[model samples]
Target: MIRFGVDRLVADPDLLGGAKRVGLVTNDAARMAADPARLARVALREAGVPITRLFGPEHGLNVQSADGVHVDDGIDTMTGLPIISLYGERYCPSPAVMRDLDVVLFDIPNVGARFYTYTWTLYHMMAACTAALVPIIVLDRPNPLGGDLSLAEGPVLDLAVRSFVGEDAIPIRHQLTNGELATLWQREQFAGVRLDVLSCDGWTRAMQWPDLQLPWVPTSPAMPSFESAQLYPGTCLFEATNLSVGRGTDIPFQQIGAPWLDVPAVLSDLARRVPKGVEFSEVTFVTGLAPYAGELCHGIKITVTSASALRPVALGLLLMAAVASTHRLRFQ
Candidate 1:
């Protein structure tokens, strides 16, 4: 089993014992010893270390909901700790939120995709902590896609295109873990945050998450399984179009299409149009939540039989073209 930073922290308290009052920034994915809030807090509490507060990322400390959905403020029902929502109303903690903390800890699992927002949330919170002169610690986990050392696809974001989604010029699937990313951000991306990353032990750059024996938790709504995450770097481009990115389905990003789509034909054309590594399966389903709820929608399931040869953003673009060729698609 891969021992993450949180795992190590629980086993050894001397590392972070120097801090007086600590603040933990996490989400629903934070778990340790069978608890949703995870071991970060429990470890600190067990050591008699003062954990002053809790900060939640996109899905809040209890990970739930679909993409772009916001979480509101409330006490963590499990931990009985005050919680702050960073995904809603604010993207970063105010100086006040960091005022009482000697150190801030971040321990969320991140899929290696650049467009995922947790890394950006790290970027923002680190900046805020920097201004407040608080040191930040990131608990590293494996990049599920297996950190194959390859250059990123898609053009680097033009400064004008920069948003929370496109924070840096890194490629769509920039092959780096949260630890390596934090290092790059401190040494290069962000100017002056005091950053410390606790890296994973027994984890190799080429090992995927399933191979690690750690539990699988969906970091975001659309990204559910290894295959869903595998398809995401490419299929996520569907969001830029009028089609639903499987928002209402049980498996999102895996099956993507709209009621107007000619599902099997599109799959056949997409299979021929893309380079290789991706297999398309025709599927029809209805959304349980979003647009076209209770209505059957035809779409194709994207499967990555081979990660080495698949180009996600390129395939996503081709899929968009296929959808556009048949309908007057607009980004909504």
Candidate 2:
């Protein structure tokens, strides 16, 4: 079982050893166990740790965005604590941001895909903290999808394509816990950072977040549940193409279609091309934001009833091909 750093900190108060002040880089999704009422803040607060500040990544503490939406710095109305937006004007923490904290705790729920910007945010923060001589405490969580050593997917991002979306050459489905990635990164990517990882006790690399008995909160606007995270590494490629990734629907990444798509035909083609753990169903959607907004687009919903039998990245590639061949899908 992987020991979650947050669980470790809770179990052993001596880990902090009466450190008076602390800061946390987190979002609304950073909760303890399956309860939304019990968040990382409450866990730390109950343990008598004073979390002086709160830091939010891309989607803000509330995880509200239409993609590329930047969160602004403000006071958290709920926590009454000052909230800083690291995903604001800059992608990384400024030296000024790291100057006051003794130890900055990181405890964000990640989707386990390399292209997700949060991992890069963590890397850059770790690098900044390393430069400023502040220790980093990572309270780890399970990757929503099991961290099994599956065949990698997505393009190994070339340096030129390195935006916030694709930070490094890590595979699309990296299949590593955030803590493990942090450790590997500390040794090779940012060795100077004073990194301390508290792992999850009940978790294993083979266990996904849904198996961990934790509640699934949308880590970002589009990824609303464990199902979305499972399909995201692949379906997210829709962002590169001129397709509506179901932004307006209750189910975002799970439903993919465009006005130009022939839903039934595409589903049949996809079934013939690559059908395994997932199956496609005809569906129609109107995106509130992005690509085909307000226009009804026909497409298929890729459902993964059984996760262990699914290969998200491979399926994603197949879907990409199917869309490209059938409809003149353009990559942005």
Compare the candidates by lDDT and give the number of the best one.
Answer: 2
Which residue segments of model 2 deviate by more than 4 Å? 1-3, 34-36, 329-332
Residue 242 accuracy (lDDT) in model 2: 82
Predicted candidate 2 versus true structure: per-residue lDDT over 1-332, tens digit per residue: 34456757766777875666788888877876634557777677777777888888988888885567788988877678888888889777778877888888899989889888889888877887889988888888887777677645566668787878776678888887778888988888788888888877777667877667656777887787888888888888787778877876888889788787876666666767865698778888787786887898887888897788787888888888777776664433
Error of 1 at 115 (Å): 2.2
User: Per-residue error at 131 for model 1, in Å?
Assistant: 0.5
lDDT of each residue in 1-332, candidate 1, tens digit only = 56778777777766785888888888766566224345556655775656778888886676775567787877977567898888898998888888888898888878777788887888888788878988888877778877777636776668778888878778888878887888887888566778888888888877876687666776766666777787788787777665767876778887786777777666666666765787778888888756667778888877777777777778888887766665554324
Measured against the true structure, the TM-scores of the candidates, in listed sequence, are 0.90, 0.93
